[model samples]
Target: MRFIFKTDYDQDVRLAKHGGHVFWYGLLLLFLLASPWLLPEYWLAQLTFVLIYSVVGLGLMLLAGFTGLFSIGHAAFLGVGAYTQAVLSNMGWPFPLSLACAGLLSAAVGVVVGLPALRVKGIYLGIATLSFGFIVEEVLARWESVTGGNGGMHVKEPSIGAWKLDSGEEFYYLCLVVTVLSTLAIVNLLRSPTGRAFVAIRDSEISAQSMGIHLARYKTLSFALSAALAGLGGALYAHKIQFLSPDQFNIVQSIDLLLMVVIGGLGSVHGAFLGAIFLITMPQLIALGKDVLPPVIGQAPGLQAVVYGGVLIVFVLFEPMGLYGRWLKVRTFFSMFPFYRRGMFKRQKSFQKSDRLK
Candidate 1:
């Protein structure tokens, strides 16, 4: 086991807690920087998808995992960003400006959604968001003038000035830079007062209110920030796929994004990347299984969905803390060795205020 002896208050919020973190993360960074040369083109492409989804996962994690907000329509924000980027890029807008507009427009929509969100929570909030998603999908499908409607839209390659990110290698580096900056931004946000306010709200809105946290302002802010990140991810996604369709950002995509955060491990930044990896690789894994399994089972149209659903159920029931949580347990077991206890990380039961009143 490792222990830290902190002499300063700032040490508590330091990004790197110890030498181990620095060493491991530094090594990982070095490996990622060189991945274009080390990985095959197909794998590199998949990794790029992973990075894009990771950005989306981080946004979802901040809202669902930290702010205790549940959304089933986040894909709407994604679509907003995607269409915005697609339209703007096609109009000869620079990549940076288009990307910024995508995020900003998504944030604006998020604020609108957040207005309704202030009145609801739990499943009701989910339903409201889900409805919003459906509305956005309909708009995308029918609004032919701006969005290209059901025919879809083609996105140009992202370029800054005269330099175009035309190759997979160049695009991968761009994604890497964005993902790194997004990760750092989230990490720093979590270290700030607003981030602490988010955690407080997640734990208990009643308690957070008692502590003078303006519920409406913060909630709206959370939605805007979350939607902004989702939009940014969507902007990247549009460029990666270079095409956009209304169906691409439908309910199923939202569920997949939610599943990514949950399976990756909610409430942990590491979970976002881990979940992205799982999300990106899962379809490939299913494809590989098709060759080995019986044709009736493996070749079924719903096989991938069934596998995804099964994995999600297993994670929710048996590993709520997610992949990161499971990793923590294993790390603790090995570190503690003979002294390890089975129930050391067990969940605690708590009653709601309504239940207590009864």
Candidate 2:
């Protein structure tokens, strides 16, 4: 196994911990830079969706994974962002301004939702968010003046001054830049004191409060940050799809976003991207399965839903830490070689102080 002997705080908080990390990440960057030229147009569009979903997954991960908050209506924030961009763009606003407005609007709504969240926990919090999502969907459909209602609205291609990111190749570069920047920002945030506060809240609220962390402030901040990221993703998605509809941001979409983070891994940034990739690619895998299976089974009406539910159940029950956790196990096993023990990664049974007292 590789080991680091740190001499200073700089090394402790360095983004790349080792020379190996820099080399591998650099190679990955080079591959991403060459992707547009290497892949077909259709695959490029798929890659764009993966990046967009990754943004959404990151938002959910921030709250659910990092801050111990549960939300089932993040799709509402995403809808708000999409509608904000579509409305502003149609009113002759610049793409950048519209996108910024989308994030701000979503954050405002998140604050409102978070107010109720402060008083609730667990299933009640989920119900509150779910209700908010329904309200947003109703507004999108009934308020035809703003959202175009059930008919939907079109989004113009994003452009900066004279340069337009209208083609698949051009848009891929835009997504790549945003994704990299966002990933770096999150990595930095997770290393900061504020990030430590979030982890504290996740581990134990009483302990975090005793340590001088304001529960209300940090919880609200988490909601706002999560909503802002979802909004940004929604804005990009609108421009990429060139259309917006209330149906697109319903409860189902929110569930899918949750699945992305849960199946990828909670409390890890890398898990978000891994989950997004899995979500985006699962449908294609099912399509491929159709050719191998019998016609009747392949043409089954609810097969996709069944497969999705099955996969989710498998991950939740068998791999509680998700795909990223599995990767860690494999990596550690190889690193330790014959020295690895059978129960090295087993979950330990333990009780919290509150639980023990009770």
Candidate 3:
């Protein structure tokens, strides 16, 4: 009888630890919704950028975290989505429907790009995607009218019936909705068996193949789905920023997208969202630092970039699991504080004892 009570108590602790994440997510939602009214326009605009970046970051999460793809050219797909929206909307297609088409176009391209994944893995594949992103940018630049040449293309404001999303605050709400929806989609996908298969493939493609998972098909689909989500984010960004430059969707942005997933923590849906907000917010904070610094750092604009690079290096070297990983550890420690004596208990033992109740 006493053992049964212990098992139930441990199970309750484990459940609360996992369940608390939902509460934190809810709090974040309320904060994002209130930001436009609560923060200055500049700050609100940054937050809106975070929402857009989060969508792209989620795609990176799907590829790198779940599938272990290590892709750096994810933004090429973003450009594909944005350019499609720009060209179609300019051609007088209705805005809402065209956005959906943009996702399809990006997905189609992703399937083609994903073909190489059947043969290549690791850094070689990363370079291949990087090359693809460059090619896409070049095409956008050389294509003249479709992409408006190197001068770039201007995008129409997004509209729904009588409503136009012109104000940053209005756009903020749009981005917020997309961010929330994209994260939910990722969560649902991760919970599904297909998502589990992707994780399996990530860990061992050979084993997964032996276990009856179709390698080429799942690989292609994961790439397509990731690109489709990136495209969705890009389409929204095109509408929000009111302009589309091929330069904005180049390899640099792709690397930045990869960095977000890495810095946020791979394999974590919440990490993608958290990373986007941090990466977006960090630059603005750095800019503020430049203003306050006396002279040494201000003389060299490169210092900011250096600092950013250094931070990424540190995270990669010491905390490859990223900030979300650290957050998990902190939660674990605090949750065990009352019951654990100087951390003497084994992690698996604690976990196993708790699991017996379930």
User: Which candidate tops lDDT?
Assistant: 1
**Which portions of model 3 show Cα errors greater than 4 Å?**
1-22, 338-358
Local distance difference test values of all predictions, in order: 0.91, 0.87, 0.81
Model 2 worst lDDT window (10 residues) = 349-358
If scored against the real structure, what TM-score would every candidate get? 0.96, 0.96, 0.88
Ranking, lDDT, top scorer first: 1, 2, 3
Counting clashing residue pairs in each candidate, in order, gives 0, 0, 0
lDDT of 1 by residue, 1-358 (tens): 7878999988886799888999999999999999999999999999999999999899999998888898999999999999999999999999999999999999999999999878999999999999999999999999999999999989999999999999999999999998999999998998789998998898889999999999999999999999999999999999999989999999999999999999998888889889999999999999999999999998899999999999999999999888887898889899999999887675221433211100
lDDT of 2 at 296: 94
Model 1 spans with C-alpha error above 4 angstroms: 347-358
Q: Show pairs that collide, candidate 2.
A: none
Pairs with steric clashes in candidate 3: none
> lDDT by residue for model 2 over 1-358, one digit each (tens)?
7888998889986789899999999999998899898888888789889999898888899899889898998899999988998898888788888989998999999989999877898899999999999999999999998889999999888888778777888888888887887788777887789888988888888999999999999999999999998998898888889999999999999898988899998888889999999999999999999999999999999888899999999999998778987887788789999998756666321433111100
lDDT of 3 by residue, 248-290 (tens): 9887788788878888988777788779977888877887888
